[model samples]
Target: MIRTTGLTKRYGRVTAVDGVDLHVPPGVRFGLLGPNGSGKTTLVRMLLGLVHPTAGSVELLGAAMPRHAASVLPRVGALVENPASWAHLSGRANLRLLDAAGSGGRRRDRRRRVEEALERVGLGGVDRRPVRAYSLGMRQRLGIAAALLRSPELLLLDEPTNGLDPRGIGEMRELLTALNAAGTTVVLSSHLLTEVEALCTRVGVMDAGRLVLTEDLAALRTPTGLVVLRTRDPARAVDVLGRAVVARSGDTVTVRADDPAALNAHLVSSGVAVAELAAQRRSLEQVVLELTGPGADRVDPGRADRAGPPHQGDAVPVRGGVR
Candidate 1:
């Protein structure tokens, strides 16, 4: 339940976010996908009133932002960038402190919320342990628990799976899925396309401070579907399938045609022997790169120098980490 129109943000002469429009429906996990310095964090901050936009408008839960942010934000929970916690406190204690400060619930209610959050994030048994003793995944879960302290209606998570191992990532995915299924609106900003593909029904891709494309994940799929045809003579296959392009290994030819079956029939009739014919589904990463242009993998040289060389630990901040 969020909408932005011509949303623009600038820093002096540089426009970090430019004229982006976004619409998110209720109870959906929408993904904001972009590389570093693509204005994803800037947009999220503007939505939260953490940063004021130079132009355009933002509405959250049907109310204009900043003017109504105070009332609306209480219903919104966010974990921006990397997870943050008081290193000395236990996981449960960290959430308890937040609950005491802003959650407005009683002791028993707060405790139940903490435990449920921990359980949802797969950290139930370990909530008694100090945060400093927890691993990166645990800390991430704790951050999520803190966000859920008040049973927020909207969750804004940035790079939620940044440092997790495979299992931890899967758990995070499952948790988000369940949250959305239970009617929580989730806006997840991430550079990991595969994770977004699995979690989000809709995706927005940003580049050079502007939203280049927003589409349902299903709409991004090829109209004809993808086909990978293998033949004894790769050269002949390419010649036979005029519209096809040879994939990375050269032996595999990828084709996007509206009628793959007809193409197969034509190839067979043309005496082109096909050793293998399989559908090649486009991954979210491939579709995003295609829509955002070929240089999607290229990082901003300026942000790279400013953020410093990447470390082994999490580089993203707990909130608005990209700044």
Candidate 2:
């Protein structure tokens, strides 16, 4: 439903969005992936006609942007940056105002749309509460309700779960999943890779100002049939596993295996001591770095720094072998 070619946008000498072409078919939950300052928001803005691109062309719902923004935008919903609502107004009140200003239809129709949106986002019961009294998650749902006020064919959300806790994030994911299952195409832009993995069917990776890669999540997640194993005796385990061994160093061995679980079991059955075993599947994060080359992770070092340390999800505990 959206296509762009050679889409370029610049702010003086610095190009915020390079010549990137994006194709989003109907009914796909698309994720735009990037680190901070990777031109994600800029691309979305250019598509929405909120920002004028310095070069290239865009077609939204088969109409050229800005030129046909009025007709096309009514079918596109967006929550760019962060969505805001009048603090003093009730959630329903905020949506009512948005529906009137944004969709422009009969007052009765708009009112019905407001109720449907509130119910759709699970804020139906709390719609009477003022927005300022809503939790961060509730406010986010309200923002999405405002977006859905137009019954948009396509929904654009930038970091929809940005500041929410784990529970809130889970709720947002479920809501987005339901929306997509109900046939609204969603384009979600996020710096968090895990969220993209959880929510998107197709993904586009951005680096600097360019689109480095785009692929279906399944295709991109193809297993390499590689496994990394830490063993009490690497040499003996390698000898026992025979041709499955790929490389060995210290007490660790990398093995070629389509099934790490079976391989681990076999090794233990043969009495090879496995300390830890982990599949070496290439993650989207790792593939992104490979595409962007070295130092890609340093784009905004301070961002990662401020976020503190990374998690230890990669390591698997296999004290006695494949536990």
Candidate 3:
């Protein structure tokens, strides 16, 4: 439901998003992953037409961005970076004002929509206390509730779970999963590996302002032609398998076998009582590290000195707006 061709943004000579070609299909939780200064937020802003691209194009919901933003954006809800609200106003008051400012819908249903949004974000029982009194997690949830005020078909969230605790994070995951299941396309932008692994169906890794890798989570985690099994007789299992056994530790044996079921059968037939067995697969961390270089957030002055004078684009400043 989102497509970009050669999408790029430049701050003078420094590029924030460089010639990115991204495709996100409908009915999936797509994760956009990167480090602190890897341009994930910049890319999300460009997609929402909040930041103009220096070169290339963006398409959302089958329509060109900015050009047709007024028509398309109403059907899209977004929460970029942090959610902002008047600290002095109650959460419900803030949402009421926001909903009133937007076009479309009958005025009579405003209260109903606001209540539904609050309830969806787990703020249904919240009192009318000023937002300044709300905790960080409460504020985060309020922002998510604001985005859901419209019940848009598409959700573009950036660092959605910033200040949430473990329980709050889990609740957000469940909420996002439920939304996706109900046919709303979700595009989540974050640097948290665990969050993406738990919530996303597809993933795109970004580094140095480039879209380095994109793949389905299942495909990326495919078995690595190795089977790990725990048995009471590790030595006996190793002796039975011979060269096929790659490593052994105490009661565990790792075998280089393509078929796990066949390997298990052989081990059991040979008097090897297997306790636990599973195929080895590459973790998302391994795949990301393999495809991308060090995070752009880290800068080594010694390396820079050895490399001589830095290029203009080499030191891309990550200000609040750019991030």
Candidate 4:
């Protein structure tokens, strides 16, 4: 569980995170979504006490952050931006060192903990090669493994599937689902809309450093009072539906109907053989695209020259254009 109120972080004249009030309850997979430099990473850092807020407060697992980070952070696992380890050391050696440095567990059990963590991240069979020799995906798995060393109750991950291949991404999804099923709270920040749609129960959207929207994924994707059906008799179906028909292409017909079942029954009764039918629902991509503006990484000198200087919360234009 995590909570923040009026959380604001500023770097001189620019605000990275502004007036954010976030609430993440236990037993839910929460996804944080935003474009690059939308203050997502900054907010994550503030939650973990890695970045101090210029104004407002942060609470992690019922305790104030930084103030109680020592007592609370040990029970939480995190991977921020990228994972780092001594390149010359073997994967096993690196994990052992991390476990030894962290709190909890007896010294004798450190090896078992490290091995278990590695296994959870699909690195159980890794050889004695130094971390520098590991592929990008391998290093990513290693970072996740290190986060699991403490058997944390809460996992706060940023770009969790960054370097993973399709198979590795699938494995990470399964691992996170299993962890959540076992009572660990999971929160992830990612640019992958489909990944978040598949893995998260709740979502929070950030734009221009503000928490623009937060809602249950199911609610956001609710039926749009329209039914799309594929039929052999598109012409006849269109005739029967009349004004209700909104779109048509080949065998598919989109009709403005509140109930797919009712629409299907009527179509069948009228001799329209329906092949497939379902209610129209919004995709996560649509939801996020509608809520957020262009990312901070995007800069157009011509647009800036035309529009003049940016307003308070607009993406600051780079003088020389995007690098």
Against the true structure, whose TM-score is highest? 4
Q: Candidate 1's residue-wise lDDT over 1-323, tens digit each? A: 99999998766566778999999989888999987767787788788776778899999999998799668877888887677777888988887777777656678988888788778877778846678898877777778877877677899987888778999999888888888888899899998888998889999998877899888888786444667887777777777777556452556677766566787887788888878877666678877777663333455555432121122122223331111
Instruction: State in Å the error of residue 247, model 4.
Output: 0.8
What lDDT score belongs to each candidate, Candidate 1 first?
0.77, 0.79, 0.84, 0.85
Better of 3 and 4 by lDDT: 4
Number of the top lDDT candidate: 4
RMSD of each: 5.4, 10.7, 4.5, 6.1
Off by over 4 Å in 3: 104-107, 303-323
Off by over 4 Å in 2: 104-106, 127-129, 228-239, 246-254, 258-279, 293-323
lDDT pick, better of 2 and 4? 4
Each prediction's TM-score versus the true structure: 0.80, 0.79, 0.91, 0.92
Give residue 232's lDDT in candidate 2 (0 to 100): 88
Error of 4 at 23 (Å): 0.6
Mark the regions of model 1 whose C-alpha exceeds 4 Å error after superposition.
224-226, 230-257, 261-276, 291-323
- Lowest-scoring 10 consecutive residues by lDDT in candidate 4? 314-323
* RMSD in Å for model 2: 10.7
What tens digits encode model 4's per-residue C-alpha lDDT throughout 1-323?
89999998876577778899999999999999988778887888788877778899999999998799878988988887777788899889988887777754786799899889889999999999999999988988988888888888899888989899999999999999999999999999998999999999999999878999999999999888889999888999999999999999999999999878888889889988999999999999999999988886678675321111122332322110000
- Candidate 1 clash pair list: 80-318, 81-317, 82-317, 82-318
Model 2: per-residue lDDT, tens digit, 202-303?
Answer: 999887789999899988887788999998888889889899889998999999998989988989998988889988867887777676533234544454
